[model samples]
Target chain A: MQKIILNQTWKGMLMEVKRSSRTKTAVSVVVPFILLAVMIGYVFGPGSELISFGVVIPEISIEKVEFVDSEIIATVRNTGPIAVDIVMADINDRIYPAAIEPDKHLERFESAIVRIPFEWNEGEPYAVGLTIDDGTRFEKQVDVAAPSIQPTVEMITYFAIIGTYVGIIPVMIGLLWFPFISKLSRSKYKFFLALTVGLLLFLGISAAEEAIEISSENLSDVFNGVLLVATVAIVSFLALNFVGEKLKKRAGASKLAGPIAIALMIAIGIGLHNFGEGLAIGAAIVLGEAALGAFLIVGFALHNTTEGFAIAAPMARTKLMIGRLAAMGMIAGVPAIFGAWVGGFVYSPLAAVIFLAIGAGAIFQVIVTIMRWIQNEEGKLSNSSVLAGIAIGMIIMYITSILV
Target chain B: MLTGGQKMIIVITVVSLGFAGYLVFPAMDITAQEQPEVFVTHSGAVVQTTGDVLDPVYTIQEVEFDPEKYLREFDYGEVSQLEDGTTLREFTIIAEDDKIMEIAPGIFYNVWTFNGQVPGPTIRATEGDLVRIHFTNNGDKEHTIHFHGNHPAEMDGIFEIVGSNGGQFTYEFIAGPVGVHPYHCHVMPVEEHIGHGLYGVFIVDPKDARQQADEMVMMLNGFDTDFDGENNLYAANTIPYYYQHHPIQINTNELIRVYVVNMVGLDPINNFHLHGTLYKYYPTGTDMVPSEFTDMTTFSQSERGILEFEYEYTGRYMFHAHLTEFSEKGWSGVFYAKDNSQPNMEGYAYGS
Candidate 1:
């Protein structure tokens, strides 16, 4: 009777374990999509109101004026909602072309230390005025200052941190291809190729939205910006088609033909977008939003690791050598360092918009290429799997952005 | 004698804490103190320089009472303080027509006025000053300036009348009883006289109750546009939708003294409602002290009161007649004040 009772107790314990395991599997599948659906719902909700719509005109003012050696540098900032482009500096009625920290970009909330070169005595006082494109003028009388070197010790320390992370990290993330590639299998690799298209699709939409929002004050600007975006998308698609045809003819159906060419295109497209991102990082640092800059760096680094996995997925079937993978990584990621170096000195609003537009166009073409490939392999893999993978890819990018 | 390890630990902890505080702790922003440079305005009121624009500090003139740069106005002078040792104050009250004004959309009224406004210019005087008014009638009507105050029967404005267009008369009195009083045409059937916009306020400021503040005059009156013997619209300062379209902007935490008078013709009584605020009420300004601290106060016809208060927070606050019908029609405005102590441009929400 004692033996029978002990056996029954063991049987009850086994049944409880099986029930809990089933619950764990169910949770693992449902929770991620549920959370993501909620976020997407909020984003698309009708009542998601904008806080301000560029009603307040940009009010720019010169905060301080100083003489660094013979050059008169004025510290200027915008104190209003809209960004104003500095057109001309009328120092004591002598007009000069306006110069900014990032040469042509009129960044919002960012101050520019403008150096006005003019003949001046050490003890003399001079009047300085700035006029914007809209004919608003800011004038101030400033006394001469003792000469000193700019980019002070404190600034130098800040530049060092920016230089390392914004420049070197993307390259390091690219080189992570070898390690991540070792884990990719045949089926997982094909899914990733399709999945990458979805990721790019999200980015392309995001860039287009940003392009519209930044220049959407007047109706004319909105019309013009949308026009430019459409033009770039069509032009890039045609150019890529022509190049793919030429490459196919030269390679003569080698295993590396499609995968290598597509991977390279993805790298170039992401690199262009990353250039725009680098500009943002550099601007955030110069604008004294260091905490924002730091957060952006961490987020971008995590994002770059995904780019490594993305490039690796394409190269898996070819048994691509480690040396070639490193080279591919450099091509994809080295442009970020170059982008960072120039971001501080030369930013044009038009150029920023153009680069982003081109990026969106390039990424859109890559999606078309992947879709065409999926059409050739129709019904080989289940449709639901591909769709699920695409959804998962877009959700990851969205979650990372909101997390920061 | 401290060991090397102990010294290193102490140094590292202090440095770490200091760096963390520098990065994490927000800096407090201190509001700038107003440096009032006295520049008495040459206008309908004695205004001192109350704000600074920049280095060469000058106040921005309130748009309502910006004085005419050139002498286009017919014989107008600013309200000024009496010269030292001078015991008399003087004024000129002209009963004229101010063209035609639109009370609401497409609704026009040719209002008979005193000094080119619906309500006559507010007369401010100190106690015991010999007050004199040179009254002129520039309208095609029989009118007289019957000011509300203590005076001899012969010098009273009701008994002494100015008839026809271009009529002239002089009324004199000794300023007494420190209180706010309503002055209007005392033509028989007072309703028509006040309804046609021939009314104003005369403020006799108490000598011992002097307080330095930004001062304004708010006259509550109704307009009889249709002449059906009832008021069609009400206003705070003669103009309907004036305050709503153009808010009275004052600095946060500055004392503002508003002299409110109710001269509504049809309405028996109307109240002033200050949203999200309270005021120290001085009924009729009869005493040097206040009667109550309240947010809403009512006034009957010809009853005036003095309210003194300062806004503690920064935002746009609506002040109107508590009667929703009156507020919805016209009698409402907003007071906008900016808080200077916020370190960031955080008040405005630009959706990011």
Candidate 2:
């Protein structure tokens, strides 16, 4: 009687397992499209709705002037958007023929340095004035300055060119490439678990370090205090938990959800980051940094693609409707859009920091989730291949550092 | 530790080296080197009126530059038209200590008075070199006399400056481009003084700008009027007005150069409209040809340019301010083109 009962129990358990494993046809068809639509909206949504009729103009009063190599470099920037269009230049009553453009120097908020390269005769102080020609006419003295020695070429070019690529592309491609191959196939669940772990580790270490560093720099032990640390940790965990649940729900049961989540989150993060990145690129282009921007594009593209795949795979199981799937895909892809917008608009490091934090958080969560899932599936020791891949990733990252 | 003498020697060496390095290989940029220099310049504001006949209350009589030598070498003349079907009249102006010998108190500030104001009585000239006027500003701040006409570079007031608190400068040039341009203070806080009525009209007579019957000088200037058009501040002093539009009126064949200068220290991308006609851009005081030049006209901030176009039909086209916000805050006006051939450049010069 005992043996019969045991057999019956085993049979029931196996039937349940088999029933659960069957992919729901309805879900497969509908969920993907839904997710895709959501992804798309998130990506190409609204940008800078915060500002209406936004027009930035930069005006400058020549603070100091120097003449170098027949070029006039003016250190001019003040409070207000610099919008003064340099009109004309005159020396002792003769029209001085020369070119006027922005100086190839980094400008901080409320301050900027512009270089107006012009043919110089090297004599009396030239009375330089620019006639702003937008809708108004503003004239200011152009303090001439000697041209600055060209910055270290290699260092600048490398960073300007390769920094962007490293920032976006490689990571994306790596993540995406993991699932498509047969032998290299990584289950969506496993990958997300691992990704979540990685992202968490990075964020935890980074945020902690950053907070501690800030405190130390100010000679304060308050941040390192148990209470503060605990608070931050708890807050971070709770936020992460909430976000994680939302992401999971969004992913649904379609194995694709894992990758889709990863992609969508990263893409959004990238979109935010790209805005600032775009500014850098635009500035670079203006300053003759085309090669650098190109290189960056490659890196960003690769990194973003991998990220997309990672986001898409986990949610793959649901087989959501095309619209939802497209939405998810777009959401995953949004980082690029956001990045591009920001890169074109606000050019600041503060922007960079905010994006970095968000990205670090999402990446951490995804990595951890992916890892756990993978470990469960393998039913063996934690995968060494992943470790190896991570190492490789690190090495690649280190190589890019060469450009920086 | 080194002895006191050794330390002193080291310190001295470092200091000397640092100073020397400042001259040779300066550390990026040396701020100390940006000291404001002492130079003669013409900088001040003046208000004036316009008419064919001079208003005895504001007629410019004498003109001189403090640093007389600069004046002797430079060109100085007014943009005016002669009565004999000619354009522009040549005259000399002296800007003395921000006060062109105060016009017996009333309402006057500039060198020559036009209808009793400093902007040297709005002078009406034509496209070609009709009249050349010389000006000298003896004011506290730097100033320039820009002629929105076909003026020569020597006469272009851009290089002229009146010293600070106690300085004088000379401006000389020929009027070529025909357009009604606003002449006012281009300094940092010029809007304050100008809003206090320190500006005038520089009428550059276009070949077709002659209207015998109903002619007027429309000057369109603005200040950040806070409460019911009251107090006005200059650039940096006045708060930014997100929405405000100022407009100027002009008739068909009438040349009007909206001398828009943002001395308000704010970012205003204003759009100039001509109701029905597509405004053709003309030369400002910056770039003017000797005989007749009109091609290479690149607009700049705080610069001047002529918007020329004739209306097909005689109608009061609403030339309202395009900037919606600027318009809402009393920054708007109308272009009542009464006649098809009536050259109307009246009221306050619409100097942006």
Query: Per-residue lDDT of A228-256 in model 1, one digit per residue for the tens?
Result: 66775566565666566666678777867
Top model number, lDDT: 1
- Give fnat for candidate 1: 0.00
Q: Which tens-of-lDDT digit does each residue in B1-352 have in candidate 1?
A: 9787658756965874574343222212233225533321112222222221111001222323211111012221233456676467678888975546543333456777888776777777767777888889988877888877788887667767788688998888877788888889876666776787888778887777567876777888777664656555567875554565455666678888888889997878889989777999999988878999999999888888989888888876888999765664457766766665543332221111
Q: What fraction of the true interface does each of the listed models get right, in terms of native contacts kept?
A: 0.00, 0.00
Candidate 2: residue B256 lDDT (0-100): 41
- Give the number of the best model, judged by TM-score: 1
Listed models, DockQ each? 0.02, 0.02
**Ten contiguous residues minimizing lDDT sum, candidate 2 chain A:** A101-110
Candidate 2 lDDT score relative to the true structure: 0.41
Candidate 1: TM-score? 0.40
List where candidate 2 sits over 4 angstroms from the true fold.
Answer: A1-241, A247-263, A270-276, A302-305, A312-329, A345-349, A368-386, A400-404, B1-352
Positional deviation of residue B252's Cα in model 1 after best superposition, in angstroms: 34
Candidate 1 at residue A54, lDDT?
Answer: 38
